[model samples]
Target: MTFSEKLRELMTARGLGLRELARLAPCDSGYLAHMREGRRIPSAKLAERLDQVLDAGGELAALVPARRARRKTPKGKAGASIARRDVLALAGAAGLPRGLSGPVAPELADYFRDQLAGHYTADRHLGPFRLIPTAAAQYDLLCDLANAARGTLRPRLWSLAAGYAAFLGWLYQDGGNIDRSVYWHDVMLERAHRSNDRQLVAFALHNKAMLHADLLDGQGVLELTRAALQEESALVPKVRVLALQQTAHGISLTEDGDARDECDCLLDQAAALVDQIDDAYPWGGACLTPHYIDIQRATCLVRLGKAADALTLWERIMPSLRAAGARRDAGVFLARQAQAYAVHHEPEHAVTVAGEVVELANATGSERMRRELSALRTRMRPWAKEPPGRQLQELLSSMGGHT
Candidate 1:
């Protein structure tokens, strides 16, 4: 039977409606409907998810056609040579294998881990556009390697693939491609489960929560972070710390009367945990610092409409942020600081900070920064004719009329 027919039969047998299946699959109902009607083919990743959700085992996944191979490059030519070069340099080898038919090297996983670390550092300074192509190519390479790998190497490669997928999701989110971001995060969660790594699983869920937080979906963030924290006692200190701070940010966005107080309590918990963390795992350790917790607390304060309080935190953190060389992050923080200035009725200061944000947004191609500036522009509409407001308007207008 066709995949859709089989899907429909399975759903009927289980008394599952379209929306119910979508929820269980954790995807959009409309996308599920299209798949049910055979208007679209499920990607291998989605097919795997649907199979598990419907308890079809391998039967459903079997229907997904293999992805078409990319067009062949010229002989002795490598596409995305920079990433390949980096891999070779890090691996200290002449070249990686072109295909997975040969026995994969056990140390290849280590090479990928190192490569991802470099990518993380680059992403801080270079943003997504310059890095995504190479990153995506490397992720595809990891997936191919994992598929043909066996024994102990298989899970390691899968874990690395999950990490790359999560990084791609974050990059897409920063670049404002929400749909692609969510898709990659789902891919990350699936691979994380396959790796049988509980810490990775928790990290995947928490990372997805970060995406929701960016979208200002307070309840969505809360739900995902809570799920991440379900096994908090077993998680590493860093994971717990990250989840706590994210949970605090979510609470601040909520309508709860005690949101600010709850947020503060959560931040305190996270900060205390930060002291227990070591540098063994560098994946998120950089963000588990006390200063990072303070940044998150500042974000929560802004969400809670305590603009002046948020500005105070921003002032203390701004110098350290610049010193850290995280240009994209600094830009995002500056945008928030600008918003606080506007809310505090410091229009001139707001405009000045916003102008800096606009430059960073253009330089970094950061949609998140642009979105922040857009919101600031809306808030400053009352002062549109004023010199400071007019300057802000012109700045946004220069960004393709995003105002």
Candidate 2:
């Protein structure tokens, strides 16, 4: 049977309807319906998800066609010139060299690292939409440099490339481009393994967990974070702390009766690890801060339906967040606060907070904030006809509505 035929048979065998299968695959039901009608082909990632959801083993994934090949460059010198030109194009966008010649200098890797640091700072204020092009270019340039380097320099270049890849992954995720986010994250994991850097490996795993967290895939977050902590002794304090906090986030997303308590335990462990981080470990970004752990704790409290407790934590952290001038992060915190108000039966307060979120989301063009606003809009549906709920809905609609 063909792929659609096989899909239909599997669904029938399992007594799974379109919406139910879509929920299990965590995809759009309309997309599943299109696939069933043979009007659409699933991407490789979606195919894999479908296989896992339907317990079809690898059969569904195997049905996905191979990606089209790029056009071939001419052999010898011509091909080399073409490749060099492409790399130079990426370099130009990344604010690097205009042209390539011989071996990639070791100093270039250091330059990339410094540039990445600047990009991180820029991302906090500017958000992902404005930064994605530059970040993607930088990642591409690093990939070219890593491929050209040799000996000890090679591994260092690969490690740097992995860092850039991870940043690009985060950018795409924040921009709401899930497919590109997954692609860049997978690239990061590959480059991390290529560098043979255990710490980088753990960091990559942690990043993937963050991606899952964005999707609210609790099990996925828990699994990846657990994998990240398997060699906890080998991780830097910062990475370990990040993994711990992420694990707590995963617990909060689950339906366990003791999720709040479990999350607190994880956060407490993370809090202890935070004190051990005396140096600026490069990987965790703003998450390296002492307040970050508490932010995660508050986020978990919100997820666990302890809105009042979350509101208390938000009140404590909002001053520091404002002082830090992390515009994108501030928007996220505000959105969460809005969620807390909605959950606590304070619709007017939720609308007021959501209005602030709309401004920040516009300023930074942060899809992350939009996503939070979307969830808030959904939560406020019970009061939809009321003025506060209608105001919140209108604010969200102004920001492009629910995703």
Candidate 3:
């Protein structure tokens, strides 16, 4: 029987409807229906998923031709590349192999690397509610191609998968989904290990430290960071700084008497590495610079109750953060500054800055900033019945109680 005939028969025998099978398919449900009617061709992955869904025992998959006819696509601007998602879909449609041997392998790598950079920026502009689903979907598609990839192509594909997972981990963490954040962090570690690249693996392990951060598990962060740094032989400047930053954060969180001194020293060490590093990668932090490290340093100092000092450093670097298109982060930093003000008993300015944070969070839809706002509201408890505190509460209520 033809592929569709067999699919229909299987559905009939199983008492499954097209929509039901399509819902369980790996690809878009709408696309499955179109292919079922012969309005479009089925891809290898699509056929594979369909076979498994219908219990065809690989029969439906085997029906996919070795190759498919290419369709025309709109070309990108002079230098821009097509989105890799489209590339994968087209390859699936044409039954073409993917990997180092595939024509799109090199282009796909470049495309993803570039998008990785763009996403770094997008993370600043786009809220987690918007970016999380997109990144998760991209990770899923990338994983499929990476699994099918072979030979020399495996390294780049795996690296992309791991990196995307890390990105998702960060996004989910920002979205306040701790479990999902940890899940992607684990996926990053698994994918990176599969790639067998020490540097990428180190990047993945370092990402787990971030997952523990939401829970303020200083010991967990320190252990994960130490594990990541053990790959020092594979370390680049970016990973080095990231590992150090987490170390600083963990140290600050600990109750040790010397934690402040140790954390301060680690920040200095990370700073020294900043001058030596000049390369950026898709893995870990390709955006690590002196400013980034300093931001971590200031944040650490704030947590350690060195409010005045941290506020000084934060103001000095505020311009840099703003210029980087990190409006969401900028809002968080403002909240930190406001926190410092509250600690210094400067209630008026603290409340003023808190207002700015509320405005920023509303504009960006950043759960990170929202969490900070909530913290600020709690901090305002002493003054809750006061005008500034009352105003902050009203602002928070306007955000659907996110604050």
Listed in order, each prediction's TM-score against the native is 0.77, 0.75, 0.75
Q: Using lDDT as the measure, what is the rank order of every candidate, best first?
A: 1, 2, 3
Best by TM-score: 1
Q: How close is candidate 1 to the true structure, as a TM-score?
A: 0.77
Name model 1 segments beyond 4 Å from true.
1-98, 279-282, 286-290, 401-403
Q: Give, for candidate 1, the lowest lDDT window spanning 10 residues.
A: 66-75
lDDT of 1 at 280: 49
lDDT, candidate 2, 1-403, per-residue tens: 5568789999999999997897688654555685787645565778889899889989877876632122233454322224344556555554545444446666677677787888888898988865654555566667767776678988888998899889988987887768778988999999999999888898999999999998999999999999999989888887888899999989888859988779999999988877687644355766675378878988898888899999999888888887888889899988898889889999998899888889988888788998898888878988999999778767777865344
Please give the distance, in angstroms, between residue 27's alpha carbon in candidate 3 and its true position after superposition.
15
Looking at model 3, the pairs that clash are: none
Q: What stretches of model 3 exceed 4 Å from their correct place?
A: 1-85, 89-104, 286-290
TM-score of the candidate numbered 2? 0.75
